[model samples]
Target: MSALRFAEDWNEADLSAVHAVLVRSYWCEGIPRETLARAMRGSLNFLLHDAESGELAAYARVVSDRATFAYLCDVFVIESRRGEGLGRRLMERVVAHPDLQGLRRFSLVTRDAHGLYAKFGFTPLAAPDRGMEIVRPGLYLQSTSERAGT
Candidate 1:
């Protein structure tokens, strides 16, 4: 395994890689390329690169106000690169990012990654009773359908 390098800088190539991966994701499938670009521009991004192949091995980002709240989203290690601890490395770097530190709260929504997040001290909300959301399931899919009039 070649040593992985982490970077905060990104380029159009990186954005393309991110879109390729995210388009296959359950949460982001059907999301428009421009939407992804816009979101990336608004967030603090962390990318993991394969030193040997120069590939974008993993990525995560936080949309935060840099004061009181941070929402961790768009986290993924490409399928070919999973199960080698890259995800853990990504989360470690994300939580320790200077701009993300000292925030009053950090949150993420994961359908099946509780174990990974838990290793970084994330847990089911202590007050699950206090948490609420107005979820729009299949939002991207709905938009796609509407646009196609299907």
Candidate 2:
């Protein structure tokens, strides 16, 4: 974590830097800038920066009520910074965050990185049959078009 800085304030992060990184992420491809800005406004965002360069190096956000539940999402590390272990440090800060502890449920969805998350106690849904969702993959593609009036 040398030469790294961590921040939670929305005003401290560059909105365009975040949007640019996210639009390239597998999970958030084509996500609109305004949509992301709105989501950040409502969520608890964790950001890592290069202290020397002032660049956004990694990020993760959690949608929580500061109570019994939290949905961890949008976890990403800038590609140029991937091998530096920023991802692990980001999760370390998230799971240990004061508001996220002792919850009955702290959850996330990851197409990969299971091993990293498992080290922090995330697991396969104990009851896959018990969990359900109204997943709408690529649901944002239409929105992008609509916003463009295409």
Candidate 3:
């Protein structure tokens, strides 16, 4: 495998590659292409591409005001490329990016990848008052309704 290249910002053309991995990864969830395009326009998105093929292999986006708080969302790595440490490399860049260096807190919710994330100083929010959502009901409902209508 070639060394991974980190892209701190994405262009319109990069969305399809990024979305391809997202749709196939374990976290499989549907995100509208237009919504992803809008998110990519922001500065907080981090995309990792295979340097050799110039194809996106992993992706994660941080929703934040660049200070105080950031939520890591939509993290994924393609199945064919797992076990090669790409996920770790992706997380390293996202958490260490200069703009994200001193946030009050960074959080994400994962269903079964706790071991992978725990290696990066992320722990379960154990406090009674400090937990995260694995899914958004309204959004899920909206998607389901839309699909059913189709």
TM-score of 1: 0.91
Poorly placed runs, candidate 1 (over 4 Å): 143-150
User: Candidate 1 residues 18-95, lDDT tens each?
Assistant: 999887798877778888999999999999999988899999989999989999999999889999999999999999
Residues 25-103, model 3: lDDT tens digits: 4454565676567766763777778888888878788888887888887787776788888889888888888777788
Cα lDDT of candidate 2 equals 0.88
In candidate 3, list every pair of residues with a backbone clash: none
Candidate 2 per-residue lDDT over residues 14-59, each given as its tens digit? 7888988888777878888889999999999999999999899998
Quote the lDDT for 131 in model 3.
Answer: 58
* Residue 29 Cα positional deviation in candidate 3, in Å, after optimal superposition: 2.7
Candidate 3 worst ten-residue window by lDDT = 132-141
* Candidate with best lDDT: 1
Q: Can you rank all candidates by TM-score, best first?
A: 1, 2, 3
TM-score winner between candidates 2 and 3: 2
Q: Indicate the residue-level lDDT of 75 in model 1.
A: 97
